[model samples]
Target: MNRPTYNLLWRLAMPLVLARLWWRGLRESGYRKHWNERRGHYGARGAGWHTLWIHAVSVGETRAAEPLVDALMALYPNSRILMTHMTPTGRAAGHELFARHGDRFVQSYLPYDTVSKLTRFMRHFTPRICILMETEVWPNLIAVCKTRGITVALVNARLSERSLRRAGRFGRLMTQAAAQLSLVAAQTERDASRISSLGAPRVVITGNIKFDVAVPAAALARGRFLRQRINADADGDSGGAGRPVLLCASTREGEEALILDAFKAMPERPPGMLLLLVPRHPQRFDEVANLAGLRGLRVARRSTLGQDGADLDSAVEVLVGDTMGEMVAYYAACDCAFIGGSLLPLGGQNLIEACAVGKPVLIGAHTFNFAVASDEAVAAGAAVRVVDAAAMLAQARQLLLDTMTRNSMGAAAFGFAAAHRGATTRTVELLQGLIY
Candidate 1:
């Protein structure tokens, strides 16, 4: 399909899309709050021109864009950035991330990918450059930007074999979109090759920007305090004196049930071990908590705990991390971390954060989303890949009991994270060439 066909299909589906957004708003009100922006009607709020515009669709993309955003801000001191998102969660994450910058960093919901809406967005923002984080290559969006003389870059880009196959189904629509990109700073050579196959004319290997993201000092301190609270001993002297914590971070929909069942079925669990379950989506926090309770496991929510987790019950078997923007803290607090979304075929969530926090990492078989990182991390002795939830827990049990191996893996994980730094700097340099 070509641009015209894609646009016609998009226009036809706009009503269904709006209805879905409205339905999602019932669970997450942020979706409903920015209705006008969805229609490309920013009005007076979007009056000024931006130097750079970034489209980071959701939370993962938003978070991945953080270091690159900072680098861009530093490189262009007086420039304004227009951040766009497709999800309320991404918008919220961006707002929290760049809140200190005030008006210099503006955010809006990306307009629908039709010619008119895309044209309106481009006219309103008047951004000289558009940087799309990860795999966001909308046909109409790219076509409109190119026509309007906007330099579009797909930075920190990645493409898995599975994604390539899916994109192949769209044929010319995907190829034309990729061909329109001025640059694609891919995370790996494999990604560059895959993107090249999709017809991106200018692809470069700039590594993964996520490795360059700095762990906030405050997050580490918070992690220490949380660890103390989570591991409070029998006598209440909370100085790393309690049970070992196994953090199941960024777990997806079906993986939680598998993990919970595995945890319950473990015949030889580590003595006084606590499971810290953090779901990937905020809307499913209550659902996850209920899942734990239904399994007869004593569950406690992070949201209900006091400022320092003072009200945390000592007898709790599972701790549900229901908060947002605290992934670093969660990683730092855990003894070992299991990266989720991989147990099934859902592609894995980011395991780099856990490694950055110097924790032993556990991943599942499916990690195509982060294929290079996962394989390299496992090869570096920083991470171990298990086949399923049972294997994950079994491995976790062994790691929890073996302190020496765990500590060694933790050190390797930190080293692995440090070794892959400077992607942001490289990407910024390339972007500078485009701007000039």
Candidate 2:
């Protein structure tokens, strides 16, 4: 449909959206807490100041924006930040991550893509410029920003082949929305081509911002501590060596089942081995934990563990990572990481964190969401791709069993990450042109 019709339909779906939020609130109470912000009711926080608005829809995008956010804060010390998110998890993550910024780092839910609400939000924030993290191409929002002469840029932008094909359905609207963007700092050559084809006037390949994320030393120490605790427990009285840890990071809905099936069918289920399963969404923590139990695997909840409760019993096959903001720790603790979302056509989750921690990564066939980076990592010998559940199991098994290969891959992963670290700087330079 056209832009006006799209807006009309979106406006008509307001009740449904609110209902969905209410339903989500039942599971994650953060949704229930930010009602006014969702309606564009943010009051005079940056009232007469130059507010630099950034929209990071959910947790992943919010995390990915961290490096860029750091650069922005350094460059524009006096300018206030108005962070907007669509998910409560994203908002909470922003608060947790940028807590030191205090009032200068404001956060709210981005309003529904309705003209009235967006106009209200625009008026409230009165931002000098807007930076969308990735893949949030709202026609209404872009059009409004353009009409108001507010510069808009899409940083760390990535347009997958699947996404571009889908956007083709709403050709005119997509093109119009793209045209409204002043600049797009795409993550790769493919993304730049796709976004330019969709009608962005200026598109530059700035590389992926995620490459710039720094893993905290504290996180690494905590991970090592956790691993030691689990090792001590799994080793028992046998004085046997601890089993290698396999981290299934950010596994999505069908992915957990696939992974568990692969684990069950392993030709060699190494003794004392532990699988750390971290679901992508917080709401699915219990569901994933239950899924593991249903698969007949002995499960331990990360949330329930005390500081010293790292010693896992040999019987415990899987540890449910029910906590948030500890991905680095998980990566640090693991011998090999299977970056989830790739196993079952969900377009794969980010593997940068795994690389950042120098862990060998195994991703599934469908990494369209991160196509270029995955391919680059594989070419760099930093990561390996598996076709499906069975292949993942086999590859993970090899990596776990073969320490030398794993270490080599891990070194490559770290090297690849280090080599790709200048994206944030280039993006910040691009933003400088727009703001200054």
lDDT for each candidate structure: 0.89, 0.86
TM-score of each: 0.96, 0.96
Task: Name the regions of candidate 2 deviating beyond 4 angstroms.
Answer: 232-240, 307-310
Report the Cα lDDT for residue 390, model 2: 87
Clashes of 2: 3
lDDT of 1 by residue, 173-253 (tens): 999889899999999999999999988899999999999888999988777777777754422222245777899999999
lDDT: worst 10-residue window of model 1: 232-241
List, residue by residue over 1-436, the lDDT tens digit for candidate 2.
Answer: 7977897888788889899989989999988987987787765554677789999999999998888888888889898788999988898889988878876788888888877888888887789999999899898898889878899999999999999989999979999899889899999999999999988999999999999988889988778766776773221111247767889999989888988888887878666678889999999999998988898888998887656654667688889999988989888888889999998888998999899888999998989999989999999999998889889888878877777788899999999999998999999998999995
**Which candidate number would show the highest TM-score if scored against the true structure?**
1
Top-lDDT structure, candidate number? 1
Superposition TM-score, candidate 2 onto the true structure:
0.96
